[model samples]
Target: MYANTPRTTATRHRDRMSYDRDLVHSVLDEAWVCHLSFVVDGEPRVLPTLHVRIGDVLYVHGSTGSRPLRSAQPDGIKVSVAVTLLDGLVLARSQFHHSANYRSVVAHGTATVVTDPAEKSAVLTAIAEKIAVGRAADTRPPTPKELAQTSVLALPLVEVAAKMRTGGVSDDPEDYALPHWAGVLPLRVVAGDPEPDKGVEGVPDYLRAVIGVTG
Candidate 1:
């Protein structure tokens, strides 16, 4: 369980906030993209990137020359990261009550450079597997030159909280009888049929499984 720090505590809709460690992990795992925000030269910067979780640590990789990666040099830099997955669109009878159903996690911590070769390799493998099961085994491992060009940063999940809104619409009792459609429009990320490259012949079973396609 994660202690609710002042930073992680919600200032609004507190009921939707969760401190459960499992909930946090699930939210992070389900969401492929994360928005990483940090300060560079006294200016705030945020960018979307892919992230993978290993235990309590969240790892993000990018070119070695990237601003954020370079900032986490010898000493780590403070950063805020957020991952959100939209579940549905709530359409209330009244416009004011309309909102989105989503699961999101916000974490605050220091983003430190991952320098260990073994750990870096594991992080890379985990990222590939996250994108598609068995992908790491199917593709060639990153060469030494490639590894030298990429940089990875690790953020520990210490001060983190998950906030989510689920279920149908929440409209005023008086507006319930209004002449308007009011309900949740469920949303999800669906994978489409894989289109292999010209030389590629067949789709891997593992890839099909990842996308929920049965034989």
Candidate 2:
């Protein structure tokens, strides 16, 4: 479990905050995109990009020319990254009590550009595999030229906390008697049928498993 420091402590909705490393990892791993917030010349900027977690480090990548990638230099850049997954929409008798069930993680740290060739390659592979379980092995590895054009930043999962809300709606006893529909509308990501290119043949086994297509 990660120890909560002043910066990591929850100031609001304290009951929803979690310091469990596994919880934090699950939330991060399940998310396809993460919002990265950082300052550039005293101005704030936020960019949404792909991310993958390998052990205790979170890796995000973009073109070498991207502003955020360029800013994370030798000394590293201070950043706040967030990942969230919405589970359901909570409907209450009263609008005031309405809320959504979600799992989220916010991390604060210095993000530094990954320079090692092997590590950079591995990270890129992990990001690809995150999209489809066994994709990295099926696709060609990035060439030296391709690797040079991409920039990856690594942020340690130190100052991180996961916040979540689950279960049914919570309404005042009086509000429950109101004449209105009240219940949770469950939400989840469902994988659609795989569409292959014109020249390609049958779906790969890995992809079939991902979308739950059985013979």
lDDT score, candidate 1: 0.85
Per-candidate TM vs. native?
A: 0.94, 0.94
Q: RMSD of candidate 2 to the true fold?
A: 2.4
Task: Work out candidate 1's RMSD over C-alphas.
Answer: 2.2
Which portions of model 2 miss their true places by more than 4 Å? 212-215
lDDT of each: 0.85, 0.87
lDDT of 2 at 204: 87
> Where in model 1 is the C-alpha error above 4 Å?
212-215
Reference-based lDDT, residue 213, model 1: 27
